[model samples]
Target: MPDAASTRAAPTASTASSTTLAIGFEGSANKISVGVARADGTILANPRETYVTPPGTGFLPRETAKHHRDVVVELARRALEEAKASMRDVDAVCFTRGPGMGAPLTTAAACARTLALLFDKPLVGVNHCVAHIEMGRLVTGARDPVVLYASGGNTQVIAYNERRYRIFGETIDIAVGNMLDRFARVCGLSNDPAPGYNIEQEAKKGTKFIEGPYGVKGMDVNLSGILTFYETYAKEHLGAGEVTVADLCMSMQETVFSMLVEITERAMAHTNAKDVLIVGGVGCNLRLQEMMAIMASERGGKLYGLDEDGRMDDRFCIDNGAMIAYTGLLQYENGETTPLEKTWCTQRFRTDEVLVTWRSEAVKRPASCEPPTV
Candidate 1:
């Protein structure tokens, strides 16, 4: 738990040319990342720490928050040192406000409030999903692209609609990343780096595709069924040599990633947008990137993510405080600062809940790609 302290008026950003610096804190889940970013889209520093649970265990909320509390001060110091900037240079402080583990989100929020008061800087509460999209656009030069946000706790196909990042599709149950992590545990894979990464490695050697229950209900997906069926199949067939971990990994990824890409393509079609940005923890998957690239090229568009250059790594793609900082800069510059009394984190913030005040201009829709209205 973070110690609470508070109060101050945030500095206002009057123009785009103003070189405002922001320090961000993120502990939405098992990973806690501290980072600094400039309004000009420059990443000053991004230092992170991830909690690794045992092979068959999941990361508990309280434990993860404890981890964040133990390392936040040290991480913040290191991030500032790497960026060659001091707290005095920061104009605002940002932290993940939600769509994450409750305890962890609160831990980061409390820390952010403390820092904001200490430095007399503006405090900004950033939605985790919007942070991912803003960071993707900042890192890759994508202009108003349809976003596919995939992570441990969230899976949403989003696009700008009516002044908001509308969620055209999302998971009805557990997220695809959670599905993969659970599967990895079932297969006795290591969760050291990330279960998803290890599962991708196993998927690469797959010789067969054991078809599991594929869930694609219109725009929404249900990954819970996939995990259930796959677990049962593994238990029933692994000892009999009928199925292997490789096949299961490949099958699960192929099935779920295809659903994610499909929903993203639908969003693109609906919005007539040509660029698609893949973000979040699970977006680092190479197989998903390949499928998405193929789909985008066929539609005369391009996919803007995955580790090809830097999308797959922790620096830009994975969960990080930099994403929060970068996004908070946009909001703070747009006058979206949070009051200390109202600086609370949520565990269920939706992508569409964000008003997206910064991106005011609408993207031009292609005539040929106009969505078919009912």
Candidate 2:
């Protein structure tokens, strides 16, 4: 966990072709990543590894930390090599600072600090949620869009305002990804690649629509009760062939994603926003993207969830180091750095806590003049 403060002295400006380069580390959960990026939002190299547990189990903090420590150094070397750059080319070191598991966050923070001190470069601590939003905006060419931020430990509808990415709506209980993972364990789904991916594949084959809890409490959503009901129903009906796992998966996805879309649409309407941007691990879901695209089109707006190549690229969509590096590059250009003494990690960091001083004021667009689709 690193401090999200700007109290440190600025490093010498890099005159390397008028663009600054940065290396970033990310081990917030089971994923460990290292990436290099330029201040102009160009990703030089981004590589990551995931620490997955076997079926019927979830990853724990201690083992996940060990995995990160074992592979992070190698990944960093690979990233720098892929970028065809050395320590001299890197202007700053950045890492995910908080709102994640403590042990994993510590591993990334320690790696980032070592790199920064060894190279005598500035250190920047980036917010994981903010990194996602910044990367989404950069890649999609979407300006001032309402963001739907969804992941394993977080669920929120966010929009940039004043000097912060404000959280307009969020989950009151468990994140949608967490609920899906827990249900996957109960159904004995494989975690080799990811539980959510397996569930999504199974859901595609499903046809029956089983009734489940729709937990929408005003602008917030509650998914814990829905997970409980699905777990109990599976135990009673799965063994008797009364319901299939695919049906349960499909039904649960529909129920929960509907809740997300509902809140995100409300945020868009409240803000009069014409574009919607989806960012997070769960944003990789094609079904979710389709649903969001439909909602955006119906409102005479566009959805910014796909890459420039017109598909979900996991390197930017999932938790990766490039997002951290790119965001840190932005902050550094704005004359912000985290002091060495304050570069400690925390697990309770909030999304709205960071001060985003890089961007100008958000511009509102007329509904008839929406930006071209990405």
Candidate 3:
């Protein structure tokens, strides 16, 4: 953490600028990021560091936390420097409060709490998933789109209703990204950048698609069955020259992404929502965006987060400090702030647990889908 007293002299009230700024810390998972943003939704700077393990291995919590603690302060300083701001210029401090590894979450919360206490700024504890959604909305200008929140730890179809981002459908077993990572391990894929990114690249070269298990039950999807099938048969197929890694990757992507698109379309039909917004780290995949765009266009709707080339900018798509900062600023503008006593981090924060005070108006369900009169 940057020392408020030693680094930069505190700005007096007479010297403080009128611009409202907030700094955010994020280390919910392997990545530790710091960001600075203005009240007008402009992200001044976002710097992040990822803790990547070797091939066929996943990042453990202890090592990930250690990595976060080591780089958070430097990243914070870099963010502030890139933003050309100081602690005294910031009006609030924000941190991701949950739905992540406990150790890494605590590491970020500790840095955030220290900064908030030292600078006497209000602390805003943002939910990790909500931050993703809000950031997607900010970037794409989608007001009431049906959001597909997909990441390593989460996979859900969501929409705003009654002061909450209600979960319309979600994974019942492992997350989509988790399945990809585990499958990549089975295939001995490198985790240098990201396992899923490598899988996406490999899938592009696949001419054959091996059949995999698809487990979609009503509003929920299950990926563990598919993962288990692949794990059990991958080695045999490779040894027998029946399937290549690229073919297996294509099979996995097709099966899981189809399930995701199915649930998202179902949610949109149920909610009568026309706009579809994709968020989270896995949302950076071009294939997922392309599938979603096709679904939206079929319904006479539009897709957010994709440019003319069906590609997404990774800045807002992946986990980052800017999302937390921007979402926290939204909360702060709504007169919501986490007090020092209530600023604890958690490992399991749900999306619907938040009362979205900023968006007070309820999304009215279409009468065609509403219940009949009593």
Candidate 4:
């Protein structure tokens, strides 16, 4: 893996402006994403490819690492090509450095370091969770909002405080997506190309609710019982008539999203933040968004769902490199860039490590003109 400390001497002002490109890499879980974005948070190109690990499998660090090594270059090349740029045009490379599988994280870091060295560019390390929040902020322009992040690896309610992003509530066990995926597999839904998508589609046809675990206690969550119950029910009752998959899907979505809504509402109340932003892959669920909107509206708060682009923009919902690149640019502008010697990867990094609000004194110059970097 690449060492985060090696710094390329600061480029001349002209060179910096001419080649100021931000590349974001996300190689966590099953997806390997690479995106290029401009300093103004405009996404140049977002390209990602998903890898499928076997079902009922826990985190296999070594296997994931190998997957990254095999696909990072291809994904990066595709992203650059889509952006209509080359290595020479890039000034900085940003990658998800931690809070993920060590093997995959190292693989991505190694590739990023090699590219930085080859192109003589600065390397920026980013937190995956922060990238999700930054994406919401950039897309929706929500400032100082309560963030609800629900994904395969994380489920938390976060608020910005004293320059850092703090977690007020989170899952005590598996993530919401993880639970869904596991349940899907148990229900024999993994045979579909996209099990989650399939489940969502089936859930739309479901009008009845079956008994399932409802373990929402305060701001914290417990999903193990729900998952276990689903597993046993699927085993014993899958062959029974009138037990449609749609009912199961509907029940699961309602139960989990209701829990999420409760926690997000509590976070908003606790923080006194009127703006509530939902992020992470699970944020794409329309039912979840509807519930959140209703909850926020009832509390006399506004809910920003980041749907300006479209109602079903899968590109933005899933983890992407563009979010990481844009976030790195924000940190860089704010003088939050960590020294090469002090930068390190953390598999369990808390979002509080990086300050939430960073102001950049650097003035924006025309694309044709050079801007000074301080």
- Cα-based lDDT for every prediction: 0.82, 0.85, 0.86, 0.73
lDDT of candidate model 1 versus the reference: 0.82
lDDT of 2 by residue, 1-374 (tens): 11111111112122222368899998899999988888767788888899999999999999999999999999999889888899788999999998899999999999999988888999999999999988888777777889999899899999876667878899998888888899999999999788998999999988899998899998899999999999999999999998899999999999999999999999888878878998989998888988898899999999975646556656577888888988888888888899999999989889989888787665563453343343
Candidate with more favorable, higher lDDT: 1 or 4 = 1
Residue-level lDDT of model 1, residues 190-297, one tens digit each, is 998999999999999998998877788988888998899999999999999988899988888888888888788887877777778888888887788888889998
Q: Per-residue lDDT for 232 in model 1?
A: 93
Estimated TM-score for each candidate:
0.92, 0.92, 0.93, 0.85
User: Which ten contiguous residues of candidate 1 have the minimum total lDDT?
Assistant: 1-10
Candidate no. 3 TM-score? 0.93
| RMSD versus native structure for model 1 | 5.5
How many clashes (backbone atoms < 3 Å, residues ≥3 apart in a chain or on different chains) does model 4 have? 3
User: Listing every candidate in turn, what is its Cα RMSD in Å to the true structure after a full C-alpha superposition?
Assistant: 5.5, 6.6, 5.9, 8.6
User: Among all windows of ten consecutive residues in candidate 2, which has the lowest summed lDDT?
Assistant: 1-10
Query: Could you tell me the lDDT of residue 305 within candidate 1?
Result: 48
Q: Which rank order by TM-score, best down to worst?
A: 3, 2, 1, 4
The residue-by-residue lDDT of candidate 3 on 1-374, one tens digit each, is 22121111111112222277899998999889998887677788888888999999999999999999999999999999989899999999999999999999999999999998898999999999999988887777777899999999999999887678888899998889888988899989999789999999999988887888889999899999999998887877798998888988888898889999999999999998888999988998999999999999999998986766768767778889988987888788778899899999898899988978777555688765443233
- List the candidates ranked by lDDT, beginning with the highest: 3, 2, 1, 4
Q: Indicate the residue-level lDDT of 36 in model 4.
A: 85
Worst lDDT run of 10 residues, candidate 4, spans: 1-10
Candidate 2 clash figure, as a count: 4
> Which whole-number lDDT from 0 to 100 does residue 9 have in model 3?
15
lDDT of 1 at 261: 82
Worst 10 residues of 3 by lDDT: 4-13
